[model samples]
Target: MKMKCILCAAGALAMCTATAFANPAKESEKTEFNRHWFMQLQGGASYTLGEGSFGKLVSPAAALSAGYQFSPVWGLRFGLSGWQSKGAWVSPENVYQYKYLQGNVEATLDLANLFGRFNPVRTVNPYLFAGVGVNGAFDNDEANALNDKGYTLGNIWSGSKAFVAGRLGAGVNFRLSDCVLLGVEVNTNMLSDKYNSKKAGNLDWQFNALAGLTFRFGKNHKKPQPAAVVAAPVQTTPPAEKPRTPAVQEAAPVAAEKPAVAEKPAPLREDIFFRIGSAQVRDAEKAKIAALAEYLKANPDANVEVTGYADAVTGSNAFNLKISRQRAESVAAALKAAGIAAGRIRVNGKGDTVQPFPGVEKNRVSICIAK
Candidate 1:
C-alpha cells in the first residue's frame, strides 16, 4: 500500500509534464512564452505513514520557494521546507516523532494555462512538479541518540548526516489579479529507510500539502486599438425651410444656396457600425442613432436614408448581401423606435462593395444620411 501511493504521485507528475508540452494556448489570445520571476510562501500539513497513532501521524509543514518562470506554462523553482513527522518504523505498531528539514529543486508545469491560454477570462490553472533534494534531522541529543542506535540520518541514500529525498506533486493556482496568484500543492517525498530513527529496511515516504501566494514580476504588453470609423458625407445643404418629399419615396438632393451670409455646413452623415455578419448595433453606437432621431424631430421636413454594408472577407457575396440588408433594416427599426416617422425613412443595402474605408473592420458599417 505504501509503495502504491508513491507510484501514483509519480505517475501524476509525469502525465502533467507530457500534457504541458503537448497543448498550447488558443489562437485568439496569441499567448506568448516569456521570462519572469516569482516568490512563494506556503504552509500546510504533513502526514507520516508508518508506526505512529493514526491520530499522531499529523504534523505541520511550511515552505519558502523562489522560481523563475520561462513562460506561463513552464518554470523552475528551489525551496526550503521544515516539518514534524511522527510515525512508527520497523513495525506497524511502533510510533515515534521527529523534526526534519529539506531543500529541493523542482520543475513546474502549468497544465491549465497550456490548454486554456486563449480564454480571455482565464483565472485558474493546475500545475505539476517533480524534484530532488536533501533532508536531515536536527543535530540535537535525540538525533545523536538515534544515530548511535544505527538510526542513521542517511543510509544508502546518504553517507553523512544529510540524506537524499525525491518528490512528486500537483498543485492548482488561481490568478487573483495581474501580478498575484494563490496556489495549493500536495507532494509525496520518498526517503531513506533509516532516517526516521527506525531500520525499516524498506523505502518510506511522507506527504506535505501547502497553500500559498506567488508574487509575479513581469510586464505584459497590450495591443494597439484600431482607428475610429469615419462617417461618409451625403448632402451639401444645411437645415432648410422647404420640406421635400419624405425620403421613403425618391427625394431629390437639395443644393445649399448661400444665404446673404454663410455659416458652417451642417453634418450630412451619421454612421453606425456593427460586427461582421451582425445586424445588431453596439451600445456605443446607439446614442448616435438617437441623435439622428433628435435631428429629424427638430427639422420636421428632414428625412434620413440608411445604407448598410457587410465586409467582403468574412462571408460569401450572397451571405453578405443578405446580412447587409438585415443591418440596414435594423437601423431603420431603431429610428422608428426612437419616434422618427417611418414614412420619412429610406433604407438600402450595399453588400460587399469595395469599401470607402481602408480596412475590413470599418467596412462592416451602416451609414445614416440626412436628406
Candidate 2:
C-alpha cells in the first residue's frame, strides 16, 4: 500500500507538471547539442552487503560528476563516488570500516526527453545510467589491528585493494531554475569479493542513496518568433462633387469642350505572414486576400505580384527554395479563391537569398503588390 501511494503521487506530479508548462511557444525550438553541458554533486549514505546487520554496514557517501548532453535524450558523464564503507566477518562477528573511492564513465538516457516532447522548462526529468570503473578500498585499520591479534579475518590486506566494478542506477532531477536542478538517485555497485577483504567466492554488492544539486552550464535551444509583416496603410478617397454648367453661358456660341483627363489609381500593397515551416494561410489572414481582390477588381488595369521567402536558419538552400515556392503558391491559391483572375497574378520564390526583413522569422512570409 505504501508503494502504491508513492506511485500515485509520482503520477500526479507528472500530470501537474505537464499541464502547468504546456507552452505552445516552445514548439519552434530546435535542439543544439553544443549547449548542454552540466555538473552535479551529491551526498548520501551507502550500504554494503556482508555478514553483519543492515544498520551496521551503512556509511557516508558523496559523488561529483560532469557530463555533456549529446542530444535531448542521450548524455555521457564521468564521476567519482567515495567516502566510507563497512565490511563484516561471519565466524568472529566483526564489522570493520574502510575508506573507498570509485571512478567511472557513465552513459545516461533521459526518459522524459526521449518519450515526451522536449521542454527545457520541464519541471521533472527522470533518467537511467550504467557504467564500469575501478573501485579502491583502503585504510582498514580496525581489521588490520584485529588481524595482528591473531584473529582470523580472512584475506586481510594492509594496503589498498583495487577491483573492477560495474554500476547501474536511476535518478530523477527536479528543475529548480534555468541553470540548477535538484535530484535524487539510487544505485548498486558490483565488485569482486576480494574488495571487502573476505573470500565470499562471489561478487559483492554496494548500494547508495543520494540527493544533490546539478548546475547546468550551457544555453538552451532558441525558439524562433512567429513571422510578421509590415504593410503600407490603406488610404481612402473622399467623394468628388459634380460640376454645374453656367446658365449665362448658354447664350454664347457653344465652344468645343475639352476632354476630361482620367486619373490613375494609387498602388496597393499587402503582406501575409506564415508560421515557421508551414505555408498554409491562416483563417485570420483570409481577410487580407479579400481586401486585395477588391482592390484589384476596382482597378481592372492593375496587376499583382506575389513573392515568398523562407528563413535562413531552418533548411538547405534547395529546400528553402522549394518551400518558398510553395508559400507563394499557397497565397496565389487564396487570391484565386477570392475571385481574382489567375492571369493577372504573378508568383515568385526568393528562398533565403533575399531577406527583405531584418528578423529571421519575418522572412518566412509572402508579400503582395498591386499596381
Candidate 3:
C-alpha cells in the first residue's frame, strides 16, 4: 500500500510539471524568485489514530516546522512533532498509554494562485506538499512494561527504534509585507508500521495544524527598475565657401545702396515655469523667467501659452489633470504679476497626454510663446 501511494504521488507530480510546461498563459506569469528562501516556526495540536494487536490509540500532539520557499510557487519544510495517547489490549489490565516523537521533510507546490480563477491582490497563495523522511518513537513507562501489574516487567515489550516516514499536506500563505509572510497549514505523516512493534506494527498517522511567520532573505527580492534607452548623436558636414560672382563686378557700380540689412529672429521665450503639484518656481529658473519677461515687454504683440504637465507616477489620470490645470493657472497668475496682459497669456494643462520624453523626468512640464 505504501509503494502504491508513492507511485500515485510520483504520477501526480509528473502531471503537474507537464501541465505547467504545456500552458503558455501560465508560463507568462512573472515567477519572480523574489522570496526564494524563508524560515517558519509553528506549534499546534494533533490527533493520532492507529490500530494494532495491542489496541487502538488516539492522542494529542504538538509540532514545529521551518522551511524555505524556492519560489513563490514551491517550498520545502522540515518539522518535529510529539504526541501521547491511550490504548487497550487482550487482558482488561493490558490497558496502556503510548507516546511518540518524530521529524519530517516535505516539498510543497502552491495551487491556489496557480490554479484559481480570481486573484485580486495576488497575495494569497495555497499549496500542496508531499515528501518522505524518518521518524523515531519512545514508549511511555506504562507501555514499556517498566512496572507491569505493580511489579518490575521484562524487556520483551520495548518500543520500536527509528523507522521511515512519509508526509502529505496543504497550506496557505498571506503576504503581510514585502519581507514577511503568514502561513497556516495542515498535514499528515505516515510512519512505517514496524516502528512500534509492541502496537502490532500498524501504520501510525499524525495530523497537525500549524501557523508560522516566514522571513525572506537575499537581494533578488528587491524591486526592479526599468531599463533606460540612449539616443545616438547626429552627424553633419562643413559648408564650402562660394566663388566670387563675376556678374556683380560687370554690373554698373550702382550706388551700394545701404547694404540691405537683415533682422535676427527673436529667441524662444516662456510665459511662466513652475513645479508640478506646487506653485513654487525652481530657483535655477528665476533668471530664465526674468529674461522671458524682458522679451515679452519688448515684443508686446507676442502671445504666451503657459502649459503644465504631471507624470503618470501619481496613478490617477483625472486627479493629475486637475493638478496640472491648477499648476498652469498658477503660472499664468505669475505672468500677470509680471505685467503681461491677461488677454495675451493663455494657460492649459495636458496632464500626461503630451509626454515629450519616454520614462524621463525632464519632460514633465513646459511653457511656450508665439508671435
Error in Å for residue 286 of model 1: 48
**Tens digit per residue, CA lDDT, model 1, 172-285:** 666686568787778888887766655567877788868899887753212222354555544465555655545656677777854654434365577788986689988989
Give per-candidate clash totals: 4, 0, 0
TM-scores, all models, native as reference: 0.49, 0.56, 0.48
The TM-score between candidate 1 and the true structure equals: 0.49
List where candidate 1 sits over 4 angstroms from the true fold: 1-31, 89-94, 118-121, 139-160, 220-371
Cα deviation of 363, candidate 3, in Å: 20
lDDT of 2 by residue, 1-371 (tens): 31332345456545644653453335325433234789999999888878887778889999999998888789999999999998887666888899998998999987776666677777777787999988888898988887887776677787798889999877788879867999888778999877777777888888887899999875544334344445557665754555666779348776776675566777787778889889999887788888889999999998999999997666667988998999999999988988889999999999877777767777888888988
- RMSD from true fold, candidate 2: 14.5
Query: Candidate 2: misplaced stretches above 4 Å?
Result: 1-34, 224-371
Instruction: Please report, in order, the local distance difference test score of every candidate based on alpha carbons.
Output: 0.71, 0.80, 0.58
Candidate 3: residue 163 lDDT (0-100): 64
Question: For candidate 3, what is the TM-score?
Answer: 0.48
Error of 2 at 47 (Å): 0.9
Model 3 Cα lDDT, one tens digit per residue, 25-109:
4322422334456566666555444332322443456666677866556678787776764444444445466667777788888
Clashing pairs in 3: none
Model 2 reaches what TM-score against the true structure? 0.56
Clashing pairs in 2: none
